[model samples]
Target: MSFTGTLDKCKACDKTVYFVDLLSVDGITYHKACFRCSHCKGTLAMSSYSSMDGVLYCKPHFEQLFKESGNFSKNFQTSKIFN
Candidate 1:
């Protein structure tokens, strides 16, 4: 049997994300609503967000948790891949 309607899943909510609700970051994907700051739970957008490893966070929280490094998460890299 072939699999159906269950290819991609959200890293945060662990729910299947349809194309319409999909929000991809780096290589990982999430439901648009599920994509939020890890600490504050604030909403995140494509252009202005930060990440650690594969975890998502708003810029402020990123700096707060990771400290004001000017450029957050060097090892994992920040969310600067938008183009």
Candidate 2:
């Protein structure tokens, strides 16, 4: 009994994601349609997003939150791993 295929649960919809439709970030996997900004509910498929405390946010919202928390810095650098 050997399992050959990979399946992951979508964090938002709590559904199983097949390998072909899976989108992962930082180790968590989600279905393509389940990936969106946690704040504004904007689509992140082709945009920059940031994850904090297991929540996803679009770049602008992430920056705003960081600024409000007094954590914004001029020397801040975001690693570009996803395109």
Candidate 3:
């Protein structure tokens, strides 16, 4: 069965909420902006994880992309394909 949840936006900011999945366990959800990097305080971003592939991350963190890209349009085409 497929799991589903709301893509809640943060009240403080417009970033989407992200869910983290742990191995063979119920996942945890957190506001994408609510937590910051331990070292740089950069807003946390979710990366796809795999036992072999591991978690992926940009060097400067995800928030930097939000700023630099200056574009926040959701990909309706991509999202619709999933639905």
Give the candidate number with the greatest TM-score.
1
Candidate 2 regions with alpha-carbon error over 4 angstroms: 1-6, 71-83
> What ranking emerges by lDDT with the best candidate at the front?
1, 2, 3
Better of 1 and 3 by TM-score: 1
Error of 1 at 12 (Å): 0.9
Find the candidate with the highest lDDT and give its number.
1
- lDDT per model vs. reference: 0.78, 0.75, 0.37
Better of 1 and 2 by TM-score: 1
What are the runs in model 1 whose C-alpha is more than 4 Å off? Answer: 1-6, 68-83
Each candidate's root-mean-square deviation in Å?
9.5, 10.6, 15.6
Candidate 3 wrong stretches, greater than 4 Å? 1-26, 48-83
For candidate 1, what is the lDDT? 0.78
Better of 1 and 3 by lDDT: 1
Higher-lDDT candidate of 2 and 3: 2
Per-residue alpha-carbon lDDT of candidate 3 for residues 1-83, written as tens digits (9 for 90 to 100): 97574575543345555455211211433454444443244554444221112222344533443344454222112222343
Model 3, residue 58: what's the lDDT?
Answer: 42
Candidate 3, position 43, lDDT = 50
